[model samples]
Target chain A: MARFKLTIEYDGRPYVGWQRQDNGPTVQAVLEDAFAEFAHGEEITVFGSGRTDAGVHAKGQVAHVDLARPMTSDALQAALNHFLKVRETGISILKIEEVDAEFNARFSAKGRHYLYRIINRRGPLSFDRGLAWHVIRPLDAEAMNEAGQRLIGTHDFTTFRHVECQAKSPVKTLDYLRIERHGEEIHMLAGARSFLHHQIRSMIGTLELVGCGKWTADDVTAALEARDRAALGLNAPPDGLYFLRVDY
Target chain B: MARFKLTIEYDGRPYVGWQRQDNGPTVQAVLEDAFAEFAHGEEITVFGSGRTDAGVHAKGQVAHVDLARPMTSDALQAALNHFLKVRETGISILKIEEVDAEFNARFSAKGRHYLYRIINRRGPLSFDRGLAWHVIRPLDAEAMNEAGQRLIGTHDFTTFRHVECQAKSPVKTLDYLRIERHGEEIHMLAGARSFLHHQIRSMIGTLELVGCGKWTADDVTAALEARDRAALGLNAPPDGLYFLRVDY
Candidate 1:
């Protein structure tokens, strides 16, 4: 079997997330359907690096597919893009490369990066309404940054994990965490070997409280030490989170 | 009567355009309805700085509303924001200030800024799929910038305007023209006292030709002097164009 690694981009607004669900359309199903057409009478399955919740966008998502047909990667990429374009699929294939038979897009990845955007202003940023979180009050950037800094390093992040997370363990090695402010917009960047379900969002939710002066850096540290899910703050809304990259 | 000036923002995807149309909902109609409701039995009208074509977004659009009530600028701003929030209108009133009785939003504008975003890559940008123009091939930024520099002056832009333009003269002063590249995206900024219909888009189309090496900077100058509408290249699509700001 020829294994093709695909770099994908998708607008998650119209999707029911990246997984196949009976409830509604999904990015995975859309790509699988496209692959089926490319295979012509052959069933096709696609493996994604991770699952993103509905309304969560991805600028650089990686996936892999194996097919019986032997075709050039460039031709396959062009054909898939053309097919997706006609359906107005909101999804596009950025690159296609033939990988070693053993290379798995998801399992071979070393780390992932995510960015959460917050529009902190008295007036709504209509241009990015659903694409970013809108907060009417001004945010304290220094406090938010200090609180986020506490999240760096490896630890058991059970407090920031979702109850339904399928990951085997809550322990994760977080490589980087930082908050940047550009005018009225605040961007939070997080990098790790992998993330537990809703972990980054939960961390952002706790940091938002710090920016609002409701919590301090010490509070975030305390939550991490507790290692109990109940110790974590509310999960921030999913509109602002984006899968930026996956490093192999 | 209190002459209230408003700065507005909108996504522009659902509306037919900024102006009210029998075909679809408009930003103007939405604002008028909200204003009329807030005024109780009093009639209200919102005047926009300029009409944005269908699917054209705005980050800083200026408007004026007339109300037969005594209200502070802060109160009106807060009230309208609250009212618009309830209907979940894609449009938002960013700022409101009491203006002179003689002031009109459209006629008193000193300058306008526009930005056209182009994603120069093989894949789509998930977050801004409908908000940007995508080009599969890499473009020459130096060539595009050279060609754009030729358009930064007063000239009869008849060749770069739509035949349906309402301006009495094709002559207008272009204050600035700049092209910047970020990652795989190309952003073009234009500033002028006023613009003819589709002026920025048409200019962008011509510049794109230069970027592709299909034409040269001197060719753009020749097209300008041609005066005939047919002398110019195609009009760029509206997806990437944004009404960035207005100087009052």
Candidate 2:
């Protein structure tokens, strides 16, 4: 079996999530169905680096597939894209590369990057409704940045993880957290080796309070120290979250 | 009667056009219906600076409205937007202000600014599907810009005007036509006092030929001097066109 790594980009608005399920359409099911045509009717199962909730977009999501027949990277990409186009699934196979069998899409990942987009404008969104979070009031990116720094480095993220997260530990090392403002758009970039479910959303929800002048850096620190889910300030919606990259 | 000016933005995916037509729903009809809710059943007509075709978006479209009942600008804006939201028309009133009775939205405009977006890359659009024109082949914006300069200044733009254009004269002065490249996106900014039907799109379509090295600057001049609609190369789709703003 030849292992191939595929980088993908997709709009998550019409999807259940990255995983396969019986209830509704998913990115995984669509990819698998597309891959079947190129695999001579052999069902293909693709393993994703991680799961993204419904309505969470991905610019550089990574996955891996094992093909029984050897094929060039270009042929694989073209064929996969052709099948995807037929479905109009809003998924694109950005690139494909051959990789060693030892490289696991999920377990071998080194780090992950996520971006949260917020449009802090008085105008309600028209073109960017599902692509960005609209915050009616103006945000203080400087204040958000200060509060973001308090959450960096390793810590027990119990206050941030979802109550139903299956991760064995609540501890996580957030390598970096940067808040940047470009005109009316505010972006939050987060990097970590791994994250418990809903960790990024929880952190952003709390940071938004700081941005709106409802919380301070000390308040974020207190929330972290609380080490309890009840201490979480908020959990941001999935509409504005994008899985930027999965580093290996 | 009180005169009010409104700054509007909308995603034009679901409407026929900006005018009132019996064939399908339009932006004007939606606004007029919303206005009736606030006017105590008195129907009102809105005069837009210009009309945008179906699927043509707007970031800052301007219009003027006359109300029989006097009200503050803020109250009018809020009520109009409140009524608009109930319908989920994918349109929003960004701002509103009181204006003089003599200020006609169509005639008082000194110039119009338009933006044509092109994603000149191989990647298929996921986030910007309807917002940008996707060209798979790489485009040379520099060449397109050079050819675009020929369309600037005063000229008989008969070749660029649509067949159904109702303008009395074909001679029009184009203030500027600029082509700019940012990463994989190419933006064409066109400015003029007014435009003939499909004029901007016609120019952009021909310039695309220039960008792909199929036409030269001299060819663009010849096409303009030809003064024949048959000499036109193409008329770009309305999907990539945006009615950016009107300068009073």
Candidate 3:
């Protein structure tokens, strides 16, 4: 058996999420099925770096899988893409490469990158309706960025963690956070070795309050100190979140 | 009556085209109906700068309409947007400006800018399926740009004009034509005071041949000199074309 690393891109709108589920289709299930077909009926398991919520997109999600069949990386990639296209799945195997047997997609030392997009305009969205969050009110990107700086280090992010999150610890170190305005859109980028569930969305939602003048940087610091979920502001919707890349 | 010049944006996938027709829904029909509702059942007509074929998107389409009822530009814009939103049309009135009574969306335009996108990759599209043209073959953008220079000046572009085009003459001057590669996508920008029906698409399709090394710059000149529709290489689909902007 050979282990291979797969770089994937997918429109997550159609899936239940990244993980396999009995309720509806998921990116994992689709990929497993495609890999099984490529392996000629052999059962296959695919491991992803992380689980993304429904309605979230991924430009470079990473995964690892083992196959009994021997094939070139290029051939495997092509075969997998062909199967995915035939099934009309929104998932695409962008690249595939042989990897060390010990490589684990979830546990390998790495960092995660995420991007959130907000269209700051009064007009309703046309082409980017589902692709971005449309904020009818004007946003102060600079203020948002200044407020976001409060969330930059190791802390017990209990206020940002979802109640249903299974992680044992509420503390996680946020390595990077930046906000910038590009034309009519405001983009927020965040990076961390790991993140508590809903942390990024929670922080973004709170920062939006600062952007629209509903809150201040001092308020953000106060909320972080509160360490209670109720202290968190609104949680940003998943529509604007994208799993940009996973760094190894 | 007060005349207003409107800047609009739309995702043209669901509409028949820009023009109103009894055969199916159209952007023009949608706008007219929304305006009528905003005008309290008053009959209204919305004139567009140009007619875009089915599945052509627009970022900055211009139009002019006369209304007997006087209202602030903001009020008019907000009213129209509310009606359009209620109807769930993928159209947005980006801006509204009170204009002179003589201003015409079509006739007063001094220039029109168009953008065409092509995704050169082997993978089948997911998010961009209907948003761009997907070409599997590798493209040489420099070659295409070099060949496009042949179509920049005034010429009798009979070979590039659509067979059913209603233009009085085939002679037209193209002010600008450029091809550039942006990462995995190739963007083609074209400008002219006016264009024959399908002229941009026709030229793009022919240039694609040059991009793939199937045709040369000399071949483009030869095709243009042929002055026959049959001499055209190919006609690109409208999916990747966007009526970018109009200058009056």
Best by TM-score: 1
Candidate 1 local lDDT, residue A79: 90
What digit string (tens of lDDT, one per residue) describes model 2 on residues A1-248?
Answer: 89999999999989989999988899999999989977768999999999998889998999999998999998888888888883379998888999999989999999999999998877667777888888887789999998999999999999999999999999999999999999879999999999999999999999999999888899999999999999988898888899999999
Model-by-model DockQ, in order: 0.49, 0.42, 0.49
- Per residue, candidate 2 scores C-alpha lDDT tens digits across B37-154 of 8887898998999999888889899999998787988787778888888237888888899999999999999999999999886656777778888887778999999899999999
* Local accuracy of candidate 3 as per-residue lDDT tens digits, A135-196: 98899999999999999999999999999999999999999999999988999999999888
What interface-residue Cα RMSD does candidate 3 give after superposition? 3.0
Which candidate, 2 or 3, would have the higher DockQ against the true structure? Answer: 3
Q: How well does candidate 1 score on lDDT at residue B171?
A: 99
Worst lDDT 10-window in candidate 2 chain A = A121-130
Question: lDDT (0-100) at residue A60 of candidate 2?
Answer: 92
Model 2 regions more than 4 Å off = A86-88
Question: What TM-score would each prediction reach against the true structure?
Answer: 0.93, 0.92, 0.92
Global Cα lDDT for candidate 1: 0.87
Query: How would you encode candidate 3's per-residue C-alpha lDDT over B102-181 as one tens digit per residue?
Result: 89999999999999999998666777776788888999999999999999999999999999999999999999999999
Clashing pairs in 1: none
Please rank every candidate by lDDT, starting with the best.
3, 2, 1
Quote the chain B TM-score of every prediction.
0.95, 0.97, 0.98
